[model samples]
Target: MNGPGCAAGFRHHTRYARSMSGNRKRILIVGGGYVGLVTALRLQKLLRRQLKRGEVEIVVVDPRSFMTYQPFLPEASAGSLEPRHVVVPLRRVLDKCDVRTARVTRIDHARRIATLAPHVGDPYDLRYDELVVGVGAVPRTLPIPGLAEFGIGFKTIEEAIGLRNRVLDKLDEADALPYSDPRFRELRARLLTFVFVGGGFAGVEALAELEDMARDACRLYNEVKREDMRWVLVEAAGKIIPEFGEELSDYTRQRLEERGIEVKLNTRLESCVNGHIVLSDGTEFDADTLVWTAGVKPNPMLRDTDLPLGPKGHVVCLPTLQVKDTPHAWAAGDCAQVPDLAKGPGAYCPPTAQHGVRQAKHLARNIQRVMQGKPPTPFKHKNKGAVAGLGLHKGVANLLGWIHLKGWPAWFVHRTYHLYAVPTLNRKVRTVVDWTLALFFRREIVSLGTLHSPREEFAEVAAESAPQPEAASRTPGQPVPKAGAPKAG
Candidate 1:
């Protein structure tokens, strides 16, 4: 439960009081996400002397204790990589800073205080001289019927694992029944029908990788055939993988369709209640699984604060990544509408890992400059390229907005780029090892669905073997005491 940089115990507001001797300034970084982790690490390196002398204290608060390298999530779910290698523990990485597992409920900039609700214990106010908002975004959802109950989002590792387990579990269930049985026909059709909404990178890559896994897994099931499964991708847009341009997007769609995936363009999912999918084009089907990766919206926590937000509910930030009209507040990553100076006026940086990492570097330097009583520099950068993998040894890419590549070369670029981009050398080495071993061995197809409810079997056995209460000692065949009256007195 404890790690380096973690305090031993909790206290009231007094815990954030400045040291009587040095009067150090406290910098509270909200959200242990891509931007927050990078910013905190860079700040620690920049303020090493101040940290040792107690002249500066860096505190990072997030609901999760680790930062997930999201790019590798699809591969993780496909069992081509280890899930644990895709996340880095904040406390271990930031040994000099404080990493608190808590949610920042509100920020009162006027009072220089932030309200934090920890995983345990009471809520408290922590005073800070500087604040960095990087709470990140959540899945953008619509008011579609049954979406909340039936649809899954491909945002986190847990969701990816759950999807993998659920898919495999369905396959296992379908295998137990004879194909000729009526129940088998219905169950197999429903179980193998997977629907994915959205045409973006997350949705496309997830569908591709999972489809690859499912096809490979079919070889192990005697009753299941790869052609029997149906994979559907519905996008309201005109094309998928818009980041890679029209050529690559078309190529990506063609590749998916060649693999028997139904790529429905300009089609919206009207409803998916009770596994019944109704599309805008009047197409109807039953699919037990539906993945929603339509888009992402800024963290709703910004609504609780007084920070100025843009039209889309993202924090309004200047070119310098400083919150508009607030001197001490700063924001970046998906939560901030950062001006894209490279694209000129009216253009903001896209919310991607590349921009988030770059913004963190700039934000750290700017914070240090402000601390030294110097002016901050504006953040300016242009997108370099984009890459997307389509299963094993297949992909599409566009480099520097000029060079386009597809198939094996793009796949290599996708892996090479992400392997280098994922944070931490330890994780990088582990992931590479996973890939190396995978080359020599087949992909692991075993599903540990029981991990979701490890106690279910034991609970069932306990209930079944539990001693039955003695029946009422009455005449044999006497009507079982059907009344709430005094135990058949």
Candidate 2:
């Protein structure tokens, strides 16, 4: 039978025998995000004997050395959860698989080769029998003025940590300036104003969590009051958190407004040039911080590959998660367009961690079936529910598309779900410990903004201490110094 081991367009029996006789078949997985990490781990478990006997090998490549549990990012940004605990070190966790910290520049499935660019050293090509494209999406940005220069995204652990420090640093800046100073009003106004564009889970959660933390943090600042802080959320859609259904969405908006946060629905951010925020509603303000979590697009690397892509630039794949028109090639996660059987004809699964996790498991099993010369089963799973943590002890959830939950109960569910979902027992324990300690202790509000440019001070010192050429020698008419002459100090 023609199977994954047998390359398409080739003689199956001969190729299968050659594959079996040669060195272990290599499975190269790209983009070590949720999908890539899970697939590699699952494959390692399923092919334990093959891996040990050198019958099969797996290699995972990603830019980052770790896989971040993105759901906890808002909490990490607000200091409710430790940032380090939100990420799983790929090398530490995937001991059985070869995890390379590199970026895949291009992939040539026809030639069974991929070009990798490591952080240090030259780029190299790797050959593989099977390829899994799990490279996740990148932030979808627009041509808004000054956005590229100012907007911050809430996607990675570093971004979360940097955001936390930035917020606190703004408070410090506001405090340092005297009220009587001419620039104080404008500086304080700008420093205290924070704008978040996007009504999705990432934007809302980040806004709510940071607002909660900032409000609480004000208690420690003599000059800064919670009332002085201006928080705004701008969404082009009429509602926020639409995934939580209409009622809960309204409730979330109401709760946010009640907290003095300006929720501008059906509004768009027209521009943010030089920290000045202009909205479609004609409202204008100066904000030191502008966070953009509007949306995400599939990784652009898909275009550089031999794989077929959907109209939206996602890797086109069958329900079985195998790349279309290609045997022994598969894809899943935000990068792949997997047909959603549960959603009926012409529907594709939404890019989400839930779907990615399930797809990874199914992808592994289907590959195993292909290896055993069995027909691959299609991947199908119903959407269970979505939970959103609005702030401390405040949340909303939609369960099974029928049951709606709000308040503390929803918050509990939100935390409980993520606590269980974050990969690795070690991370789970660390996250729980952070929450437990937070129950009794206040959140850390200290700003480590200098960490962003830790070398600045050293650079300044070096510039000050560096030897200068004598003034006369530097003059236009002056003669050059002799090689053996005493140097002019």
Candidate 3:
């Protein structure tokens, strides 16, 4: 699609050639994720002149209709932004590209064919002249018993909404019953006893925001006290936010402790049996909520593919972002292990969103060059450092080169960078509005508990009131003794 906002024009079906007698090649891209969208969008613009050849077609396949900007997810969960704004619709942004909302079940580079699992119905095969694999990462889950059944993963927009609903509903359950009821108090504590694993960006921000929200909500409940609830963060490492350096980790730890959150460093989640969470440290905790954000591995789709893979299951891409020796195929994002040319140490770039975005732009340019028979340039980006949000208007950041920031300044950077990075003007404005509204309005403290079981309570009552033929037969006004009459006579 061509637009004023777009850097260049993009058309998908047609191929670019110098003459009308064009033998156009087809480009097949996998995973309509962040890296995939950017690569396709950039190629459409860079190779606009090429698509006019009417020979080459570009096909993008993925399960999601939209690409979610994950950094804004915490704010979305915290009610700091509307949920809808965090996702960018695939069809609206990539014009002229054949966007297929399907999963790529298998890829055979040896034969240059990809098998696609359609969103519904039958599966089909798509043969392409070139292939791009940008299948992003998935949640890294352990084999701990009840991990999948009892615990929730903090990935994607769906899980974010689920967490919010579950949290509010638990609060409502606590408040609905009389304060004197033990079940009511136990439920209230269970609701607030939320546990999060992993101390990375996802774990820290989620823990802090939810902790802040819960602490504020305690003001509204007469029985639920701030001290009564527990917020535990379990990290296998010795410190939280290791990217923030030693001092910042200490600072964050202090900040959380002040908020009454317990940080369990050098710990592991052993099991979650019947919501009773046992730790490697021999500590046991019974929680109604458990969130796992330990880490992530590349999508398993790469395992069966013919492309070369790294030790971590990431695609082996050259400095040019092309699959090693395969000039036609390219990859990026968490799924690709692109080498850092500048370092000269043969080190792979970290699996981070920063690297992913940078690689996408480079890959876009290289694809354009490849389509035009021009030599592709290699990708080399300097480390830009890292930043993290600890809680509302508070954070820590390591700026470009080596400058470290903390308190409000770091928080400002965190907000500014994320707000700028959040795709589309509509989402940006809506997020600002959510924050502004929060300044004036009281935090929405009312939890809609009935949403969990709108009918179960009534069903229980109905079952109790249901008529019993045995009881009715024995009632004073009921006829009974017909069979026994002959015997009595």
Q: How many pairs of residues collide in each model? A: 0, 0, 6
Give Cα distance to truth, residue 338, candidate 1, Å.
0.5
* Least accurate 10 contiguous residues by lDDT in model 1: 3-12
How many clashing pairs in candidate 2? 0
Candidate order by TM-score, decreasing, is 1, 2, 3
User: Which tens-of-lDDT digit does each residue in 338-444 have in candidate 2?
Assistant: 99999999999998899999999899999888887899999999999999998899999898999889999999999998888888899999999999999999888
Q: Ranking under lDDT, best-scoring first?
A: 1, 2, 3
lDDT per residue, candidate 1, 27-96, as tens digits?
Answer: 9999998999999999999999999998999999999999999988889888888899989999999999
* TM-score comparison, 2 vs 3, better candidate: 2
TM-score of each: 0.93, 0.91, 0.85
The list of candidate 3 runs beyond 4 A from truth reads: 1-22, 52-55, 177-187, 442-489
- Candidate 1: global Cα-lDDT? 0.90
For 1-489, candidate 3 gives per-residue lDDT tens digits of 225422221122122212222366778889887788888887777767667666656778889989898887777777666778888888887776878898898888878878876555555566777888899999999999989899988889877767877776666666666777775666666666899989998999888877777777878877666787799999999998887788888888989988889999999999998899899999996899999999999999899798998888999998899999775789999999898876677788877888888898898888877777788898898778788887777888898747989888998899888887766576688777877887888656554445556899899999998867765656587555565474223
- The TM-score between candidate 1 and the true structure equals 0.93
Backbone clash pairs for candidate 1 read none
lDDT of 2: 0.90
